[model samples]
Target chain A: MISSFQKLTIAFTVLAVFTGANSLHAQQFRPAPNAHYPNHALMPPGHVGSQMLLRGGPIPGYFQPTQVRCPQGGKIAVANEGKFVAGQPSTLNVGLLIGSPYRFKITEIPGLPGTELFPTVELLDRLHPPAGLETRFPIPIHLTAQELRMAAEGMFITRVIYLEDPTNPVVVQDDANRQRFFDVRFNEDPLRVADQLGRPMAILRMGSKQPRMDRQTGRFMFSSPPVRTIMPVKQSNVPEDQLQRAIISTPSIGRLR
Target chain B: MSKTMKTSSRSYLVLSVFLASMMGCITPGTTSSGPLEKQSFENIPRPNQPASLTVSDANSKPIHRASPAAHQQRLPAGVATQQGPATLPPQAYTGPNAGIPYPAPWTPPGILGPFPEDEYVYQGGDAYQLTNVAQDFSIDNLDEEDTIAHYHTLDGKIEIERTNRIPIYAPRFASIRRIDGLNQYRHQDHVYAVDSPLALDGTAQNIGQEQVKQHVSTQRNIGTRASSLYRENQKLRDMAHQVASTEDSQMLKPQVGDLLNTKVNIKNSQEAQLSIQQQTALAQSDEETVKEYAYDLLPYKILANNRIQTNYHYEIADGNSRLDIKKVASKQDALPGELLEFTITFKNTGDKAIGNVTIVDHLSRRLAYVEDSQNCTVESEFFVNPTGKDSAILRWEIIEPMNVGQSAQVTFKCRVR
Candidate 1:
């Protein structure tokens, strides 16, 4: 006669064998991390994928000089430090560097008073102009009163400035003094659209976040970042080509003073 | 008397059954065939053609054999024969059985025959068009043990017999007694029982009982073993003595011939040191006085001269222990740490001489100039200046002015950091 202990031992052995057999068929089929999505851009910035596209030297006239044109009766200040007077009808032209972002203060809107908007400019590319003529072809950043009002009213606005494609130019009779721009829906990416149309030059973002600068308060504020200023060329009756030749023949030509 | 009669009857029955089984084993009769054997014979397929028979008397005349023409026809068409076709007789002949060819065609047996080739021919359909595909079978419903179908039931259940029983005659004894081996010992008494046969004590429980005895024979070569051990010890002592004596001799008088002569001669050592010091001082002074300049980008000067067209391009240098140059356009991508070869070509298309031609390049901070990599077709003076870390300024001044229709090129190498 088989005792209870012997019967239990046999039962346990049989159970273990069955368990092992079941385990063989119970494998979890986990796919590889990048097997399905090989080109996934999940990695953060500065990764190898992003750095590979950052080869070659900086574009010509990088950080040389850029002129910022404001609305009429409006004034502009660099980094909200009030560089330009409140009532001055002048445009702020600072030599913004690529690979860095700069913030600016917009004040004295024609219709809206005490409405100051801080906008950030991120330069993605630069123009290749002749030496000492960097200011002549500065990146024109047009801040409309509508965008300023929206930003002042706590609405976010994003504008992408792109260099028009010479091969495929936009056929529009736009004002020579003002840049040609368009609007996109909220769900659309302005930068991507700008790249599709032409070469994306810069990205501008404006919102209603006030500065947090306070003494001994571990606070942050939009302090004016030092920039090289380029003097505008004097108005003359000289031909463009002759003027370029004159500049090239000078002894200190092409050298940034 | 009744029991004996019953026993005899049972024996008779058993003997008859055994004889019957033995007869079946000895004879190959129809009754002895198993189910499998019968089934195999019953499954044999009928032949396609009926067999034919031939009858002849023992004293019949010799039969006419087939002519040589028949034999030649059986041979391959290309094969050469000793006799020509014209000399051969007519090949018509009669088979042993009526109405049959001399060389009958062959066919495989029915059991070994395979399905016709047309049955396995692929039908036209696109296997890659997987849209609206239907799954008709499940893995769970598959019969994994179908290959061994005979061993299982219709439901695929394998029944196992775990218990086995056999008939045996009953014993007369009512109880079973355990038999203790010779290793039995009483722990409480701490002594062997007096009546035990293997007891060492000289006391016997019975007066005339015999005690178990054992006899053993052994042969040990003590003298040979001792002599061998002594010889090994003496050999070890000799080795130890030799090592000790050698060590003592070396300690008392070291061998000079085994040592290497390592004395090196000194010639103008102080002069060499002074020259090295002077070179270091000059390098230090140069480093202290070197001028730094901001980088500026400018197009090739020849772009302004319609008479001379300047072409500037760069190529990636890659190979296995050698340079394999491949041109890369400005829009193409390049990897870091790759070697780049830059070339500037200048051609004179005018009818006059171009003099004092100088070319300068401001290398980007990302590129490091390779040492001694500058090359030029014309005699020129090359100058280099470090603008910043991993950056440099290169300038070349052509010593001889280029004449009409003259072309010159300058090439250099740099590694992207």
Candidate 2:
């Protein structure tokens, strides 16, 4: 009995009401991004935070040896001006050829059990080797009070290396020249040196072998190859003030043959 | 026509009565009328307003009213509604000293006696004595064999007599001198005469002398050649002993004597008196003994009588809970969005009666509390506010009583701003 237009209007009104209700219900059920929920599906196992957020990178390859030579007419001297007590600073003077770019770092090699030295070094300007023709860089080495005390107490003899930056990209003419520069420093046995005057040595790295890594675990399967060449060089005991003059006066470069 | 009209009226009356009864049964206490008229009738006297209309009968007494001044003096509605100040109920005493303040015990610093002074005596004899001689005294006519002799001589002169007597048979004599207002003996000086050559059988004495001479020569030769070798051997042994004792293999290296003089043993053993060069050579070969010697040689101070003692007391107060919480962070400042770990420590600073405790911490909007970071054996949950983003609440309830000096800790992690 209803007219066709009226019936069509009624049908459209009923359809609109149902669709609006359905859309609102769907909106209410949709989860919002960034909302904190009780479920922890994304958390890491063992309650450990992201590795990148916790500790820093792996241990640095601190052991590297570079060739260090005394300038013509001078000798390298590593001297402890004060008594070798804990918290004392020692001086190391190395003679280098003028206009040569060089970087140096000191690394503490663990000695007998309980013997430790905090390996730290101040970097000097490589651009300009000191002004005069007699060029020697006097690097001050500071030992922690505990390290010094341990050394004095004879807990352990500390062995430190006055290493040249082996990673420096420098051009060398021949193997002989490189060998001459890379010769050992402090040739005397480290154990025989005064504990206060830490045994100085050069830790030479011959070459690196390929390292193997596990395919599935992504962890290193094999240890890095060991360094074979550790040549002990002879270090002279020269007064700090006269060290520069001694370098300038010597006619031949003090290189271990 | 009159009879039909009467019947219709009677029917109308009957329908009206039935309709009224039906309306009453359908809706109790409501009338079937126009909405506007019903609203006007209901609003005539508001049910909420107090009844101000006075009802009077023919024999009723006149109503009395309070004056305006009396109304003004009446208390405000808020004051009139409030009950009188409550009387505090008496509390039952739990113990003899309940509700009493106990004074804290006082302790004073330990009184120590003065350090004992070391008694020192001069070991060297008359070398340290100062001498001032005003006059010289001398003795004369001294005899070697005579035990007693008297002589007068010039001032400051002393005679010496040598006797060929064995030490046991020699007579004792004392010489006194005044030094530093004190009398001290100067009896160290004594001289004895050499004995004449003994008479012996000719061949036997000569043979004995020749044997002595040969023995001396052989010893001299061996001494010169083997001394260096023996010393070197001893040094090596000492060094080996040191290396063994210290168990530090790093010190084992070839012997080098260049810096031997500078090397000092931290622990100086009974045999540590060896020369520095020798010790270094020994240390190069033997690690333990050398390390032990070095340790002994180190100048270590002895600490004595430096400890302090203290006593702590825990007291509980009436109706007061004494639980405390301390928040600690591994690092205070971090980069934006960096993860930081936080620790909350709860301590019971008083007596053991402190009951179960509940802790609630509101997470800052900038931080995102990590899931499952709560480290406690209790009911703990993280709740996010429905209307706020990045804001949450962390709640924990501890059901056990925390005793005095007892503490527990909870830890969680969050991304810091």
Across all candidates, the chain A TM-score values are: 0.63, 0.18
TM-scores of the candidates are 0.27, 0.16
What is candidate 2's lDDT per residue for B219-264, written digit by digit as tens? 7886687778899999999999996655433243223333333344
**Poorly placed runs, candidate 1 (over 4 Å):** A1-53, A59-61, A80-90, A214-224, A232-257, B1-417
Worst 10 residues of 1 chain A by lDDT: A248-257
Per-residue lDDT tens digits for candidate 1, residues A1-257, read 99999999999899768654444333222222322322211122113222323644443224535566566678876652324324334367667656445667777776788777766666665554323344555666766666667677766666667665322333222222355565553333455555545555666667776665564531232244335555553322322222112111111112110
**Interface Cα RMSD of candidate 1:** 48.3
Q: Which has the greatest lDDT?
A: 1
**TM-score, B chain, candidate 1?**
0.21
Per-prediction DockQ scores?
Answer: 0.00, 0.00
- State the C-alpha lDDT per candidate: 0.42, 0.31
For model 2 the local lDDT of residue B36 reads 39
What is the C-alpha lDDT profile of model 1 across B47-164, one tens digit per residue? 3211110112101211111233433444445555446321121111111111111122122346321211111111111122211211221112111000000011122222111111
lDDT of 1 at B358: 52
